[model samples]
Target: MDLFTESGILLLPRDTFLTDTHVQLLQKQRIWEVEVQQVLSEGTTENITNQLMDLDADKETVAAYVKALDKTRSLFDGIGRDDKPGLEQFSDVFYEVAEQSMKQLGLFRSLYVLEGSDSYTYRHSLNVGILCSLIARLLKWGEERIAFMGLAGFLHDLGKMRISKEVLLKPGRLTEEEFDQMKQHTVYGYEMIKQMEGGSELLALCALHHHERLDGSGYPHQLKGDEVPVECQVLAIADMFDAICSDRVYKDRTSPFEAAQLLWKEACNGKLNIEFVSHFVRYIALLYVGARAVLNSGEEVEVILIHQDEPMRPLVRRSGEFVDLRHERTLNIEKMIG
Candidate 1:
């Protein structure tokens, strides 16, 4: 049975899936069958819920998580308008949803591949949770610390909610005044999280220091690398990965391969952590294998994992020449395709 109905609501085995016709009827205010509340209140199928709890990384189940994220994004976008849906309430929903998604993603190699540009703010937060959890697992961090870092990723961008939509969605460079106001989002997000119930100072610091650079050049507070919390550093790297790969209204998206290259270059320049970049790149490269993508020449190809030293530039099979992307001077991954 399909997990989602035509109206894009979850449907358990006990409930029937709605067709597009049914949604049209509802839109026309027919209201006879499947009221809005009944549709939304439908719980996930028992099987799916079990898979989610067990952190299964099966393809179908992971797709369900992606669908759930899309649904939550719609719900979140409706918050804080004239209707005044409490921003805190909306943030809570994302936190809970992300916690669940992260657990499932953690069972896999890396959450970086699931990262995309379509839904930036919501998806970026979720990706951060996944990456942070993976890093925590790799470091053998205690359970409590892992949970705290996961929560920190969720709250990393809470400050953005306070920024005006005009500024947030602007397609070009910001004025000095607008840029200054945007910088305050970090502080705003930290204070907002601190005021919430069950809020941790550690998590708030993630929101605060996520933008800080190792060279003490970042905003709000120019904390040097040694001064920043280790947890914040992890989140900072994850945040940068997601931001560069995602297509913002103001900036074009970069491929994960290119982003990784730039991150490594930054580390070499002492602006980021070299060890962390190495580990993050290792995990991210695992996720790209067998994934279809475009080459610099705009040809479609499939990645073939090889050579641990150069994971980002994998051997690819395009036409027939097993092109070692790392060695090919002219070929590089342009973008990930279906």
Candidate 2:
């Protein structure tokens, strides 16, 4: 049967195949006693029942996420208009979502898996915010600093609102002129934030320098090493990770493992902070320890363990056998299926 939240948002369509992950997500949303077709064989029913046992659930988290997305959409829609949203407006909504996201990693993980393809900007903003906060927590920062990091990440792309949709949404290689205009988003965001109430120089600078790299290879001011603030450094990692893992007009989404590898590569090339990349990439790799993935060789496997030295190349289980990616260097995880 079809499932809808109390707020009337469709949660799942009728007859959707319920994987173990799906069931766990529903349980997290406090959804129990779902009506399903009685077509499962006796053995399948027993297996599902066993998997459903001892699950924890919470409804508010999912509801808060939906409301946060709606709020984000509304705020983005008002950009470039007379009633553009202020820093306070964005913070108010962001805190609500951040509170829910911090409750558990599962909610944050589910967001990536269940996200729709539309509204890329709004979704990207929210996801980056959550990721920034997560990275801050992983760094053992104080609560206030973590909150600031999230806000910084959330507003880092505000300048994109000023770009012409024709250029922003173009699906092919951009003309040199178009690319130059696109790069101005940092400047635009900086100006916009500077004008907003409660927006500080640091906040505006985050929007300005988030694209800046350590190797003097970044734009708006090719700042190298310490020229970029530590805050902007963190924002750069979160921003790049999300962009690579997310679908864009011109490219398909890469898997998180692959994205982590790329981040590590960039760090090694002096474009990103190697220490920060090491910490964040290890966490990202560990997050998918139990996930299902398709390897480059077309074999489906379940990640069984993450090697600390090579988190991206984990030990995986395939067809009742184990494949140690560390030794099987020819094969790599192509993408996650769930």
Candidate 3:
């Protein structure tokens, strides 16, 4: 059996699975590896299990991460634009390695987001992976398929490495010429993934077809509905979700509710799969449960669980008016108050 340590290391055990409690204890102590002789010399399985089960979830780790994400966003803003090519290449390598590590750990969680980014492409790629994994889990996809989608999501923009920095970061509207160049990253990413070892054609297909739309109006190829693979369809939705939500030279980062509203509208307009859009919307809204938030009235509160039918508006208890955000169109979630 394979055992995972708290430090993110894995070891092969002679026999038996570690109890959930032992996992908790290791998680609590942050002592990933103990020379079995040193830590467990004569401890019984029941003893270890009891200790770990008593440990609480790591609040300190989560708080540290909130601070780290703020730092990472600032770091991305400062990275030299001239190093776009190098950063993009390194981003691909990083995600590829992250993909392998994810498979080994059986974790399809948001480590890619934690990995952070020094470039726009890398940041967007990691967001895609996080968003895609969220969608996959909501759809009840098996673990391997989820990981494959996560990897595909992470490298969906691998072709951007070939595009020029000036075109990518241009503050003004892209001229027709610059716009054409920007679109080539999809094809560029496909070719790179195709050449990589152990690459899936499905993943490369996501690279090629993520830009294609249901109305036959998207770039690279104008393939309409049913012509595109399901994987491609899913990736396309994930790509659009990440792109619209992030900050750009011309656009500020969109609020998650605003992004969700847009996704809902796009689904209605036939730009996304209705089922995929519905489930993905539900998935993302759930992740922010317990997050501190601001209402349009400027009141502060923590979000409770979402109402099952009306996910766009979660049930939140604030310090002021007991307004139900779902019913009150005027009051909305202002932002995540980190």
Model 3 TM-score is 0.66
Q: Scored by Cα lDDT, where does model 1 land? A: 0.67
**TM-scores for candidates 1 onward, in order:** 0.74, 0.81, 0.66
Note the Cα lDDT for every prediction shown: 0.67, 0.81, 0.62
RMSD of each: 9.2, 11.8, 14.7
Tens-place lDDT digits, model 3, residues 33-106: 64443221112223222322333324343323233333333333233222223334434444454444333321
Better of 1 and 2 by lDDT: 2
Which scores greater on lDDT, model 1 or model 3? 1
Off by over 4 Å in 3: 1-118, 296-299
Rank the candidate models, highest lDDT first: 2, 1, 3
Q: Give the candidate number with the greatest TM-score.
A: 2
Which pairs, if any, clash in model 3?
25-52
- Supply the global lDDT for candidate 3: 0.62
For TM-score, candidate 1 versus 3, the one ahead is: 1
Error of 3 at 29 (Å): 42
Q: List the residue pairs that clash in candidate 1.
A: none
